[model samples]
Target: MNNQLPPPPAQMMQLITGFWTSCCVYSAAKLNIADHLKDKPQTAHQLAEATHSDAPSLYRVLRALSSVGVFKENEDHQFELTSLGNTLQTDAPGSMKAMAIAQLGDHYNAWGNLVYSIKTGHIAFDNIEGMSVWKYYEMHPEEGVNFIKAMSGLTGAVIQHVLPEYDFTSFNTIVDVGGGNGALLVAVLDKAPQAKGIVFDEEYVVAETKKLIAKKGFSSRCETAAGSFFEFIPENADAYLMKMVLHDWNDEQCLQILNNCNKAMKAGSKLLVLDSVIPEGNEPHPGKFMDINMLAMTGGRERTEKEFASLFSNAGLKLARVIPTHSPMFSIVEAIKE
Candidate 1:
């Protein structure tokens, strides 16, 4: 007989009820609770007043999050910021506060309809929100702006890891296809001071991207181009970068974008696709979960190395290699135009 019994049932329950924890963190972030506690410990009542939340209810949520190491609830019912909680602070460098709001607040409704996606193989975001995510952002400009900030926050940390691992020394001009707010493109140009860049996106996004590029003093080295990736990209760049862009699209849509890039590239030019590659086994990887998130929200799916190779081949490009970086969430899926 096998020596071990089945594991405790509570673990299963915790997994099933994981959304409860997600919502608590989302609520805390939305209330700006960490910002309030940045200076010192504060009782729940004080926090409630600052955030305009119910004192008892706020206390319960904070107490729960405290158990998970997000905050420390003292003997006196005061809460102090923990290292993990500090990352939620609005002013913290690489802060995830906006991302928390976007994912758990703005994207939460779509995620709730995950079963719809499984049944119909359609985008849950469209079903629940009455339009695609891009259209929804167009209608709600403020939310769109917040979403951009959230993306910047998430990518800011990722770019630091990417810059050191990838070499841009040889490329003179690079283009960031679907680059939002020009954060990643600016970072790239800053690193390769001799290299120039272009931030290509929809008209509205490029309007804002211009401001960001100028703000970073990359106006001299970086410029903005407004267009759809499915139609055209700037031509003849030494390198084309699509970071976190491919995973937001289905294969057909991704191929359309890639075909455009292929047409825009010179024979020896490169395409640097930065995204998480789903590992082959059952080994724990965040991309496996994030793939489902893409399916739910964007009608996109993350891929394995084999899938990426197929994508490149279909788009008339050749997969060169997959370069690992310090960041586990993404890798450089390098390809060359044939």
Candidate 2:
């Protein structure tokens, strides 16, 4: 007989009610609680007054978080930042503060409407926000800026992993398609000093990129262009690099962008797609969860290697290889013009 016991009911309940813990972390990050406690531990009332929250309620939240090692509860309801909590600081290395803000503030609503997305096969963000997530951000530039910061925080470490693993020396000009803030392109140019770079994005976004490139003293080697990927991309590029762009779109929409890139590519040019590749089976993978998030938020899906190859073939490109990075969740999917 198979002798095994299920987890305790309380443990199962904890798994089911896990969003509460996430919200606690989000609230702490949003209120800048970690930064406040950086200097020294402070009473919950002190933090409450600084953050304009209720003392007792804040104490409850912090106490709950302490159980998860985010913060530590001390004498007199004082709370101190743990190592995990330090990552929520805005200026900390690999900070996730902005991501917490965006996810808890705007994304929370979309996730709440996930059941509707499941039923309708459409994005819950559009239904709840009454506009596409992109349009909503366009209308609210401050939130849009935060959204970009959030993405940068998420992508920054991944860029470090990508820079060393990929070979950019072979390419003369690399167009960073949908490159935000020009960080990736700037990093690429920094490594491959001989190669010139272009940050291709929306008009408003490229305007920001111009400022960043100039600020980074890369104005000479890196430039900016404004356009939509669905319509056209800069032509005759040795490589077109897109990180996390394809996952924001569905298959048909991705084909539109790829077709545009294919039209813009020369015979020997390459297309580099950087995103998560969902592995087959019931294995635990971040891409599997991210695929559902894409479904709820953008009407997109993370794809497997076969799915990626099929997509590339449909766009008249040949899948070259999928290179793994130190970051297990991300990979480089390279293709060549055919």
Identify the candidate with maximal TM-score: 1
Q: After superposition on all CA atoms, what RMSD does each candidate show versus the true structure? A: 2.6, 2.7
Candidate 2, residue 327: the lDDT equals 74
lDDT tens per residue, model 2, 1-338: 97676669967998889899899989998899999998999998999999999999998999999999999987766888889998898887667899888888888899989999999998999999899999999899888888898888766867777668898998999999999889888988888888999999999888878888999999999999999999999999999999899999999999999999999999989998889999889989889988988998899999999999999999999999999888776899999996
Clashes of 1: 0
Clashing residue pairs in candidate 1, if any?
Answer: none
**Model 2 TM-score?**
0.93
Residue-by-residue lDDT tens digits, candidate 1, 245-303: 99999999999999999999999999999899989988998899899999899999999
Candidate 2 clashing pairs, residues 3+ apart or interchain: none
Model 2 ranges with Cα > 4 A deviation? 1-8, 74-78
